[model samples]
Target: MSKADNMLSILWMLRSGKKMTAQQLADELEIHVRTVYRCIDSLCASGVPIIADSGPNGGFQILGTFADSPLMFDAEEQKALVHASVFAQEAGYPHTDALGRAVDKLKRYTNEKQLTQIERHSSGLSVLQPPIDPEQKGRLQCLEEAAGQRQTLRMVYGGSKGDPGTGSVREFDPYSIIHWKGQWYTTGYCHLRKDLRNFRVDRIVSLDVTDRRFERPENFSAKDVLLEQLLPDPAGDPSLVTVRIQAHDHVLNELKQHWLLGHALIERSPGEAVYRLDSTSLHSYVPYFLLPYGKALTIAEPESLVLRMAEVSRGIAEHYGSMLSGLPSE
Candidate 1:
């Protein structure tokens, strides 16, 4: 047997409470007695409590309490488990109540050393602020339940476009509730629009499960639909505007991860890269997403975005300048 298999077999024998000496274990496994002693040492190093005695009547034994313990995870596995649980709890994963209880139980089962490693690993992971609010949570739960039941739902949903404060109410057949981009959305068959629609759960003012039932399309796949919506058309209008920017590879790589960048390209240099951003709505993309990069970003393209960037910069400078003027300058 290989070294790992030998160690596993030795562990099994010790766990059985037979109290076999190293010589007896070597005889059973047809290996050197020295090899058996080394395997036992390996097991001990992995946190297994294997005890050995030197006297004539004495033999090898495992700690009685540890032998009966059902938990089998090693230190690293325990740490990984704790890290995953804490991440889920912080990320507003659905079924928060049940997950929270399960995580609490997991903490109870972990030892002090394992807990220390968990804390160390978790310190590097961070979930950004403004977690799901109560209204959004309740809406998500309602959508989840409705999707499972395949019940038609009535919702007052706003548009994803400009100033959608007061939206119209409509009936929809709930298909699925999706968690994407740190937001929860429900995709369903909209009776009002007579087509498929995706509604943001946070934007939904009210939701009601109707008594009417509707069958989801036989060949419908939520993943396929989402991919189609997310991935931009590569063969789309060849006349797509190319807006270049100068930024570090790290910043450029971060921008590439966005769903809207599917058709974009990045040309690399020594320490900087020029990004070719292609979007139908440059106005929205530039102000909301690109401007946040500040001075690291420079527009090298059609005069429109360059002017827009300058205009936005001036507006921000004026706004801050006005605020600064209200305070006494030193």
Candidate 2:
């Protein structure tokens, strides 16, 4: 995460009415204690009213009045919020109409000079440039409606294709819709599986909001579930193959930005830098991720991957070779 992200995240943490120690902040942000303190200093410098108490039970706190007002933001905070709002809007958030109104209201709150400055700066800002499928909007809307009403959703869900009669109609108590890794998912209690399940919005073949309402688990945490199920394990999975990449900083940064698994950053010392890659599906994920990097990266593990890369190179060469062969003889 960037410094600006850390500052805003700290503010959000305090806003939740929980006092967080610097150590707690460091753990959450995956940064050192000194970096957490530095972020706190940056937040304070930016005019955030963060309060620190120095008792054993005490930690950092922010008064709730700031949230109640809803209009307080320093210049940097305003820019960050505006940028986030733009991203959310572009990403087809379920509450797009409300987000649009909120952005307009925020702009109205800005003074003439601030508005001009924001406009001048925002011209260069853009996010969520990926092409969203048209069907995604409908799926998000259905999930949102079900979650809001505490209603169950009856849908035809397509799971991993195995054989005949694999995918089937199912009912689930929709709890929430979450955006993760550029895809939307709905988590709920699946009646068919007799357990909680996360359904990718795009994989839902069809959906209908049902009259049956179900209570969400009081302790249900979407973030916890996502972390447990989605994020690659630190020790690496025994089943999935490990890929090691040696590359320059620019390529590493690009990989980090584009792929979360690539953000591992195993080692960086002088000219020797290495990144360990772990994903749920190595066959599908590795080739797709490495193709764009081309010759910039070197694969250091999993002999299968080296052979796969060779196969891909051969396929590309064959494709071009055939294309050239098809041309009229000179």
Candidate 3:
């Protein structure tokens, strides 16, 4: 590795629960002890708080200040940080309560004029969708506590399959709360089912902290476990459905760029694209994809989808026709 890369690797190794001797670092980086010492000196000169001990058992360690110090960033860096903060808040990262504190610290370090600019820019930037309901306030608080203490929580969750008036209750041990696609979800070992499960925060009825505490597995990470459970099962058989659209370049560009369609674009032309979607539920997305194009687009798909779109178009046409006929003769 290069000198810079080796220095970063050294920092990462020391930051975690590991101690590295100069000899060890030399071996890892294929360098000599003198070279390692020179790298260490370079790091210390760069304001990286690396502490060295001169005993048989002591090695190199990262100082607490190194981990806790505020980072200096240029104007562009500041804007990027603010943008990420806004995005996190929009996505319901319960820990944003802590981000507010960090932002306050940053403001203190920045000059009055720079701080003013930052505030103005942040205020002007807005997320398209507002945050989800704050009803998960208590749930988020409980999850935070569980994560910090590595404790288990016995909570009552409402099932999604039930009616709003009649929700089924289940007890779960929350390992972590994750925000996916603007929705908050908690994944953990389900006490009632004797296995892992994920529950949406909005669907949870109540939360209860239990006296029972369990040891977190040595290899367990809430984020990793949640992602594993949330991924769609790939073992299912794939189905191919063809969908055709005749949208203008603007719409086609959006479709290519943002890829509003969940499936892959199988084919495209000057003003049209054909998608080979894996889902059988094509009806759900047809209306949305067609709405932007208005009368300029047509759906030529699995005969059923074509019929459904025709039916919707006929309804719209009849409604417009009735409205025009109802207008006073002029």
lDDT of 1 by residue, 1-330 (tens): 888878877775666566889899898778999899889888899999888877987889889898655455665675676667666666565678987675554544454555566668767667664577887778777877888888888887874425344678899887887766777777878899898877777788787788998888888876666655554444463655666666677877776676665345545564444434445466656566777888776666767888877888899899999999999978
lDDT of 1 at 107: 49
Q: Per-prediction RMSD in angstroms?
A: 11.6, 16.2, 13.0
Candidate 2 local lDDT, 12-41, one digit each (tens):
666656788999988876888998899889
Q: What are the clash counts of all predictions, listed in order?
A: 0, 0, 0
Please provide TM-scores, in order, for all candidate models, with all chains considered together: 0.62, 0.64, 0.58
Whose TM-score is greatest here?
A: 2
Instruction: List ranges where model 2 is wrong by over 4 Å.
Output: 1-81, 105-124, 131-134, 159-167, 234-236, 258-260, 263-280
Which pairs of residues have clashing backbones in candidate 3? none
Residue 6, candidate 3: Cα error in Å is 34
Q: Model 2, residue 318: displacement in angstroms?
A: 1.5
